[model samples]
Target chain A: MISKVGRHSIRLVSELGELAGFSGKASVALPGQRHIMEKLTRSIFEIGVRCVPITLIVGLFTGLVLGLQLYYVLTKFSSESLLGQAVALSIILEIGPVFTAIMIVGQAGSALSAEIGIQRNAEQIDALHTMQINPIGFLVSPRLWAAIIAFPILTTFFDLIGIYGGYLTGVELLGVDPGAYWNRIYEAVSVQNIVNGLLKALVFGIVTTMICAFQGYYTHLKSDIPGARGVSQTTTRAVVYSSIAILMFDYLITSFQMAS
Target chain B: MSEATTLKLRGLKKAFGEQVVLGGIDMDIPLGSHTTVIGKSGTGKSVLLKCISGLMAPDAGSIAAGDEKGAPPCSYMFQQNALFDSMTVEENVALPLREKGKAKATEIKKRVSDLLEQLDLTAARKKYPAEISGGMKKRVALARALITNPEIILFDEPTTGLDPQRKYSVFDMIRSYRKRFGFTVIMVSHDVPEVFEISDKIAWLDAGEIKYWGTPDDLLANPPEDLKPFLNPQLSPA
Candidate 1:
């Protein structure tokens, strides 16, 4: 049992190291990549524009639920006017970035992983190498750049829509003073809070995108299975691992911010 | 290595774990000649081709280009015709040039158009790989491989899942293109007498070694003892 535990620990560390190296190489290759703006635009369309509807739907519902629950809780303490502060802080600082990332993972990250996995299985990657092309530069660097540009933008959208959902529930439906709610939100949210939230989104974007791409790129070598089954397995792992990384990094970033 | 030689392999060795693939392969491929390496299913013909193409590094050996230059540029046509499904046929054919970024957009377009016209792929230029037939995919792959005007081209089982007629057509296309382009061809194939038709030299790989290397007629006139069983399965000691 001890030996087995030790073996798994070592494997985990080794995989983490490999993931870091993969991300580093992809990042380094970014400057020299050809037709990068075109590729980056396509990636942004896939990862950002296509994900808007789902992100908005999830964001609105989360705000509505928070508004409904927090109104009653504030009423218990005769603090109903604090609803805006609560909603804005929750959406901007935590829910917005986290949910946006998870939704993108379900849609764009999974697709990226599967596409790359299929390419690997079909020997298209090897074909590129034989053609004297850098596979990572051609295949991955644009996606990374797209994620960096898209994540913060999506998170901002989620936050604005979520705050509106809260306003509808807190001021229009419930009976809190609109001026008080808006004023509380204005006074409560500082530049630092918004900056911290966007920073989290940026970090989550880089980490999750790298994890998904890494998993798919090395699917053939990593999976015990082969062919379509192997592609499926690695793609599933990509989604799961990316989602987990988002949450884990959220905690680490949150804790670090709080400490400092 | 003679100036006539385009590629030379000396003591090329590769093994996966304990299973030895290519034990010690030594061979020279002449410039502008078609050489096919034929062997049984598990005898590592693909492995040897990959090693030569720099797709897979050998465990212990040196692969040399005969030119004074360090290593000649090579293009590989994979067994499955690994064309990018997401890219249209024209885009697929032009990808290597586009990635290399050495040519302008107009030049790339002209070169791709010419190659596609030559390969009878102009009609399918806008279609994706999934939309095209297998033979057309092979031609597109060939166009991509030939676009850079590589000094050497490595083909890995270029006709694995094709009918005999299509297979023969692919071989004819390869032979005709080789003559036109003057590029040396190193192919791994299993089409037996069919493959011998286009090959200038045939290297028989078995037991992790090159057991026979000669012209097709030479191999047929005096087949080695071990190769005879493979050449004519009825001669096997069943």
Candidate 2:
């Protein structure tokens, strides 16, 4: 039993090593950067344009709930004016990056994983190899780079919509003073705070896409069986792993923000 | 045909964990000749082709080409007709040339157009792989495989799932290209009679070794007792 466990552990470690190597190669630019423009455009549309409505809704609801909940709590202490600072801080420092990434993990990351897994099952990746093209460079890098470019911008969009959502709930619905809400939000949220959130979004984007792409690229290496079922399982695992990475990295980035 | 470029494989062995797939296979593939590798499913005909093409390394063996310092010049048309779904048929065929980056854009486009025209795939040039028929995809794969003009081309079950008409067309295409380009041909196929008709020699692989290697006529005349069953399955069953 111990030997069985040991063998499995060794296999896992080796697979992780392979994934790291694959991602390292993908991070390097390929020879034909101009050629990847098509891929980049497709990925940006998938990760950014298609995801906007969902991010907007999630961000708005999150801010509304935070505003409504914080209003009641702060009112108990008669410091209800702190609602704007709380809402702005929460949206800029935590909710914006984390929520945007989770939405993308559900939307774009799963699609990327499924697309690549299908490609692997269909032997398209092997065809790339036979043609002497680096599959990582041609297939994986553009998506990774596009996600890195899209996530921070998406998070910023999320923050703006969320702060407005907070305003709609705090001043109009809950009867908090509009001047206090706007003034506190403006004074409390700095460029550094927004930058920190964007940084977190950028990191989350890279890590999530990398993990998902790694899983898709190595679907065959992960499973013994060959078919749609194996590819589906790998895609499912990619989404789960990518979501976990985003959350874990969010905590790490938050720690850095606190320190800085 | 160009002077046959000989590819020699010595003691080619491959294994997956405990299962030994190819146990020390030794064979010579004469350049400019079409050779079909026949074996039962999972008998490693495809694996041998992959090893020959450098897609997969053998566990213990050497695939010696004329090149001393570089990899053997070879291209493979995979069994599945692994065409990129995102790209049009013309793009798929032009991929190898594009990846090599040796030819200019106009040169690559002209070569791709010429190959497509020869394969009768000019109409399907703008269509994606999914939009075309299976036979067309196979031809596109063949075009891609031959575009590199390598010393040898490896085909893995080129007509495995096609209808009879498509299968014969693939065989005919292989025959014509072998004559036109003079490049060596190594194919793995389950379709015996059609493959044998075009093959200069047929290699029978069983139990991870080349059990028989000779002309189809010789193989039929005094067939090895072991390969007799594969050579004439209907008669053996009767």
List of clashing residue pairs for candidate 2: B4-B31, B5-B31
Best by TM-score: 1
Instruction: Please give, for residues B95-161, the per-residue lDDT of candidate 2 as tens digits.
Output: 8887666788899999999989988999999999989888788888889888887778888898887
Q: What local lDDT score does residue A139 receive in model 2, on the 0 to 100 scale?
A: 78
DockQ (Cα-based) for each candidate: 0.88, 0.59
- Candidate 2 residue lDDT tens string, A43-94: 7998999999999999999889989999999999998898999999999999
Model 1 C-alpha lDDT per residue in residues A1-260, reported as the tens digit of each score: 99999999999999999999999989988788788889999999999999999989998998888899899999999999999999999999999999999999999999999999999999999998998889998899999999999999999999999998998899999988999989999999999999999999999999989988998899998788999999889999999999989999999999999999
DockQ of 1: 0.88
Q: Which docking band does candidate 1 fall into? A: high
For candidate 2, what is the DockQ-based docking class? medium
List TM-scores for all candidates, in order. 0.97, 0.94
Candidate 1 stretches with Cα past 4 Å from truth are B1-4, B67-71, B234-238
